[model samples]
Target: MSDHTIRAEAPGDEAAIYNLIAQAFAPMPFADGDEQELVNRLRADGDLALSLVAVDAGGVIVGHVGFSPATIDHAACGWFQMAPVSVCPPRQLQGIGSALIEAGLRHLREQGASGVAVVGNPAYYERFGFTVIDGLAPASEHDQPYFRAQAFDRSAPAGTLRYAPAFG
Candidate 1:
């Protein structure tokens, strides 16, 4: 709800984005503590399909959301994975994260992306239209409960969805 602008990640934004993500996830019980590195790896491998950052009125980076190409059944299916959505500790719970996610999804829709998948809290992500597809699922069984998706076009594809290599 703060006065912030959501925009694509720009040059020199990496460091700030990195710190922001790290700080955001550090307190989460389920965080793997490698999210920051994952973002770096995604960028390094050119697998970052989309990365958006939220800058507050003071020009401070407060939130970020990343999207990467994901394959369905071992083949590109025009689908993407949304991950590592982060909001600075002090800026969180204020709708900044949701705003970042909406902006990223909007951009992907505009680019004609087939759909997007996410692994997270069902109650939270479901608000964005993400749902568990009967046949579509994530690679890891442990992620089954958290996996949710949204298709931009027609019905969601049914198959095993794999995240980018960096997710390994």
Candidate 2:
């Protein structure tokens, strides 16, 4: 396995990040043909809590992950929603995605975030301590079992998870 470093994203990394996301989710059924738009919207809104990228020794981007503000409609609560986690198709299963996620989550926790949510593969995300949250809804009404969450602090709030307007 080649060594890859995961770090906070830089300004010039947008195009590479977009391309990685586009390639990773290209065949998914739920995209509705606007993956690039979603990426752009997230970037433009400045709602991202943490945007991370995995790079090779030479600094070539191989994966990307983003977390933005999420709410649970409860008190003393501020959570992050993980979205658009993408690993270059050729780099899948090489721990790049894991690095991005772990690094991003650590950053969020350091920033005092209470929790984090994710709409992704159940089996895969569960490895990162995420679990299905009943009665919690993604910003949309989409019925997906992969819509899950995890609290960094055990005392984090609980309720229906709400994402930003970009998800609508």
Candidate 3:
């Protein structure tokens, strides 16, 4: 059945959140296996702008996503970065990740964020309005167009992007 619910992560879902992230990234050969720990660091450092989860009809957390503050040319107030989005391996391809992203973006818009950036599969993120613009790229190794942004307002800043220190 296709009836999972997308909701903000609660204070007590730490273990489940970590497991979901671990499970989702296990198949990626390039994964360094530190994504969940990064989430913890983000939470500990107060950089997590938002954290959301997709709970199946059976009340199991099957997907998750996080947004954190990022900067462009030293400006830190308006832009955010979406990262470490994950869904349980069994839950992939069921729209759970998409729902998490859509809900997170809606929440960010409601919070008045000016933009969101992500480094991900180009074909997948393009559906969410993320596009490569000049002068914006992640500090990570990947330099492809998958480093993209979706501007909430009409203007998108042009400069190097620095994700939160927690990403280190």
User: Evaluated with lDDT, which candidate comes out highest?
Assistant: 1
The positional error of residue 34 in candidate 3, measured at the CA in angstroms, is 0.8
Clashing residue pairs, backbone N/CA/C < 3 A, model 2: none
**Model 3 C-alpha lDDT per residue in residues 42-75, reported as the tens digit of each score:** 9999988799999988899999999999988777
lDDT of 2 at 19: 84
| Regions of model 1 farther than 4 Å from truth | none
Quote each prediction's TM-score. Answer: 0.98, 0.88, 0.94
Put down candidate 2 lDDT per residue, 34-126, tens digits, no spaces: 665676788789876688888988888888888878777643267888888888788898888887888888788888888888887788999
Candidate with more favorable, higher TM-score: 2 or 3: 3
Best by TM-score: 1
Q: Candidate 2 deviates by what RMSD?
A: 2.1
What are the lDDT scores of the predictions, listed in order? Answer: 0.94, 0.78, 0.87
Model 1: per-residue Cα lDDT over 47-148, one tens digit each: 988999999999999999999999999999899999989999999899999999988899999999999999999999999999878899899999999999
Error of 1 at 29 (Å): 0.6
